[model samples]
Target: MKKKAFKEILKYVRVIVFFAVITILVEAVNYVMVQPGYARYIIHTVDNPDDGSDYDCIVVGASHGRASIDPHYFLEMEYAVNPINMCIQGATVIDNYYMIREACNNNDVKKIILELDYQYWNKNLKRDSDFGDLLVYGQLPFTSLKMEYIVSQLMDKDFRTIYFRRYAFAKNWKTAKKYMAIKKTDEYKNFQIEGVAGIETEGPYQGLGFFYRTKVTDKKGKLNPSPWTYDDLNPKVQKYFQKIVKYCKDNGIELICVTTPIPPSSVVSGAANEADTYFKQICDENNVRYIDGNLIKNEILNVSDDDFSDWEGHMNGELAEQFSEILTEILMKEDNSEYFYSGYDECIEAIKVRGNETKVLKYIRAAVFIAVIAGLVKCIDFAMMPSGYIRYIIHAAGNPGTEEGYDCIILGASHGRSSINPKHMIKSGYAKNPLSLCIPGESVVNSYYILKEACRNNAVKKVVLEMDYQYWTNDEARDSEFGDLFEYVQLPMSKVKLEYIRDELIDKDFRTVYFKKLAYTSDFSKVKYNIKTKLTKEYRDYDISAVKVCDANGPYMGRGFFYRENNNDHKCDFLVQEWTEDDISRKVIKYFQKIVDYCKDNHIEMVCITEPITPTAVVKGPSRDANTFFKDICSNNNVRYIDFTLLKNDVFDITDNDFCDWEGHMYGEAAERFSGIMSEVLANGNEEYFYDSYKAKIDEIERKKS
Candidate 1:
């Protein structure tokens, strides 16, 4: 018995070891392939300073501060403060806290200048910490702080973002090969700033984290600032802000929060006043110094729209020098009120708000700005979303309902999609209107929504629910947040969709919802093609031919069915995944029950059907029990349960050649035959249509064939 138990344990041990080795190998490849970027430069600069000297002040924030403040100017102007700009692009308040801790640990830093970019702290903005953490994590030293950051922030992100940092770049071999070659170089290995900066074409990398861009903003370009409101403060960002304050206070470091100056063109008339009021209120409560560059008088720091590099408020090289000088004076002066206006209104008047625009005109500008942003977001949604059947199914109007109410609708995964054709059922005169809504790899959860969507739009009299046994054993198919995104984006806005978003997508990765491009594997070369196609008449018209002609399957025949041609030489030669009772998912069952309940409540008849499979693919497992489980649920619910796998050999015989592949997805000729047979069985509703069990049916098929 001991020896038998040891052998049993050995089998499990081998499986665990196999997966562990795969995990390690994948991680190792990701580490080698990840392309070095901006994070490496900034982290390396602080880790290995050119002079190897400590600084008196460290500037921490996002790109606005990085380009606005030149630390070298503080030294050149003969100030006692020796400063280094530690402001990283896209750094959040959480990132700021870690950066301060890292800088304080490495050097004798006496003060921290926290640059305030309202975009990071605004409640309404869609900020992604997962993507933000990815930029900083790879360059961090192997210390407790690094481990803590990984545990806190990165643990929730997609593992691909954590390990494969250059996920987007991996699409192009030219880009991938370039990075791989760069990784082998001595400069990259040594963390040399020159070598890192040389690989990309951006602005000149001034030492101490100061980046200088020469390109100036077009004076005619609109410069709209991200909106700010008291109620819109992000609590998580506020928490980290307080942490930074406490960290500075405990260490006897002077902490000043500064909102760097923007071009006059970007300022909405009274926007700065409200922002400054909130900043001062928060600063007073914390006993921290606050400075608003927008409030600075024009005489003290004369900046124009031409001074800015872009409408978003990043400064050109010339503007940075002027701004840095003004920054120095603010540090030097005992009372800096001498150099500034009372508030934003005073500053706008001083700067001359483009032909002295009235309050009504300012509101108009704000309205126009919002409209442009909304339009851009819609364009981005179109560009990023990949063209596929899911998009076609969701967008197409005549999908099993809408035109005329469907007498019956088929819903399931790829197996049902390829096997059953609604046209065949309609031609058999069993139903007036019937269509298939099955999509490839669709889960029960997805099917529920599709049913809801169909019912919401038009009268759906009956729903044919295809029961794929494999989905019950696979958690990914049952409840993958990433998998849901593909359907989620294409779904038309409705109460059902709103509930779907709340229940399914609310806490998932923001990238999955906002960055639609990241949901699937996309070739960068096709981005132009995707954008262009979206603008075409065919796409806007929801022409089925766009997908039918382009689909990998033979063609989309219609009503959510893709007809794959029969391969004469192909044979089904795979085994079904064996599972025990424990392998079944409660979530899958819950959604399955929901579908049944929904149909009943709506006064519609619902039938559960298991599509036939090749006899060779049957295995000794809980498949029998699984089939009986569904049969019991349908029986208890007063819904018809038909396992076509147990259908009489006289009704229909399925051979390995009937299927296109080992997975039992039927080819075109086979699908039509099965569809005709299924129509007859449903029309008759006879108990004599199916055999006693799946095993008995398989045995009968083999006995008859032999």
Candidate 2:
């Protein structure tokens, strides 16, 4: 039994050793090239040998603290204590508490200056600490403090990223290459990191981050501020703030919580005042000193827009110098802590504990290998999904409804889709149940099947084909056309969807059919993280945005009915350009014939509609443009043709005011008016279709114009 146990122990030791070697190698690379922040912090710590011992006073906060506090201000004043501004952008109260905790563990500190911003409390949400901790963890040393923060605050994914250096460094390979090349520069080598736990680093103005741009306009000029009434304080921030107070009291470190000076443009109505009131209450409960900078801005301090970098609160170097002087005077007069942070040698102990290799951690090594492999597979599959915007066409194509009847179905591009409202059509008695299916930047080739599907099982009594000269000139594969997945991604995996893919996409865009993400890959940009987060994730439900036909109430009234509020901008400025249908894409002519044939075979009433454009659209009086061509085709085939392109006195007049949103779509009233006109035509049949001789009317108008 003893011999067997010894052998098992030896096996475990070997596994532990294998992981230790890999971890050391990964961490060594991570220290130099994992994340920009990681490299910056490690270098700062390595270069600046002194821990928190050098700084008797520390200023801690977010980007505001880094940019608005001048450490040299205290150094120049030659106060009883040395000070360092330890700030990073997006550092919240939880992060601030960790900074203090790390500082107390390593530094000789007499006082702690917390630079609080009201903007931090503006969010009513419980902060997404998983994300917030990304900024905090990169610079933190692997101490008990860091371990606790990681365990309690970080998500499993974040924990994996931070603890496993290889995992953290893999995603940013290209960045690592560039950083490795530039990281050895003079500024990087000489960069200073002050304060315990290395919270402070090199800055721009005399090595201070505090400064403002001279050419940039005051940001407040761009926004129209309105009163924002809400009393929901961020619960997590309050909890962390209390924890910071307790840490200060327990350590015998004097703490001063501050709300920094902010300009009017950066603050919404009464936000600053309310923030100050809340902060005052928190301070009173804990018996900590508090400074409300907004309350004394012009009276005690004369900072202006000229002194700020932007409207959202950051003071320039000159203003920071002045602010620091005032702050120092206040602290010197009021500070009560005489004893400094002198006992803890937690840094060495932390290094030892972090360095220790354990047997159980070997399983984490095995798990990392498995998780990484699994994640790679998931990412590849996720890239293949077409459930985003393409879902609209898929949902419509795969619609399981068997009712083979629609009073009318409008087919074209986005204009055709949005121009006609099904609810209004039904309510006005033009078409009992209408479905407007518009796909942006779609070719008529796609619409042929879309219309066929719309009419498949439904008793679509009428077909309204929306067309303009442009609809007949699709020569190129539009960037938005984005071939295959638009047809296949959203469709249910069945013979019908599969056949459509094989017929429409197999030879059409074969490469894109396989690697479709490349279809719009050229549009991808390396935007900043903050911006990309908002753009990609916000309001991104394609089903809600794309599907216009909703029978939620009495058929989705006023849902897709859109009109530009301050219209009447002579929207027909396109009249400035000459219109022509002399060049129609062969594809358009083919689809037009197909539509007519399909309608006739199905015994469906086809309305070959020339949708209204701006007044200067195709000159219709006597010209042989798309309108005349469509009219001629409809006349030969005995189909009803209704041309509504001109604002002529005889038939219909659509002006800029008639269009509510864009180039040629009608407003609600205009749509209703047009719907009424169509209803009259369909109801009256051949005798009342044009209300008079349509061809004779066109010839009369032409004769008069000539």
The top-ranked prediction according to TM-score is 1
Candidate 1 per-residue C-alpha lDDT over 45-132 given as tens digits, one digit per residue, 9 for 90 to 100: 6766567787778899998998899888777887635678988778888888888888777878887889987778786665655566
Q: What TM-score number comes out for model 1?
A: 0.54
Clash list (residue pairs), candidate 1: none
TM-scores for the candidates: 0.54, 0.45
User: Per-residue lDDT of 1-706 in model 2, one digit per residue for the tens?
Assistant: 9999999999999999999998887677876565445224522542243443456777788877766667676777775355666766777888888887776666667788898876666454434544565666666767787778877677465545666554335356676765555455554445432211212232333442333222334443333232223466666777888888888888888898877776543443335555666777779889998876555434356655566766666676667767777766666665522211111232223223443544777779969976886676446434433233345443543353546545566676655544555565666567766666655555566666766666554677777777655556544544233633554444555565566675556434443554444422232242233233324533243344433232111132332333223345343234232345655666567767887888889888877666565332333322235567778868988888777553244445455456643356555556655655555555554343342444554554456556
Please report, in order, the local distance difference test score of every candidate based on alpha carbons: 0.75, 0.58
> What is the lDDT, from 0 to 100, of the residue 358 in candidate 1?
56
Residue 406 lDDT, candidate 2, scale 0-100: 55
Q: Give the CA lDDT, 0 to 100, for residue 303 in model 2.
A: 56
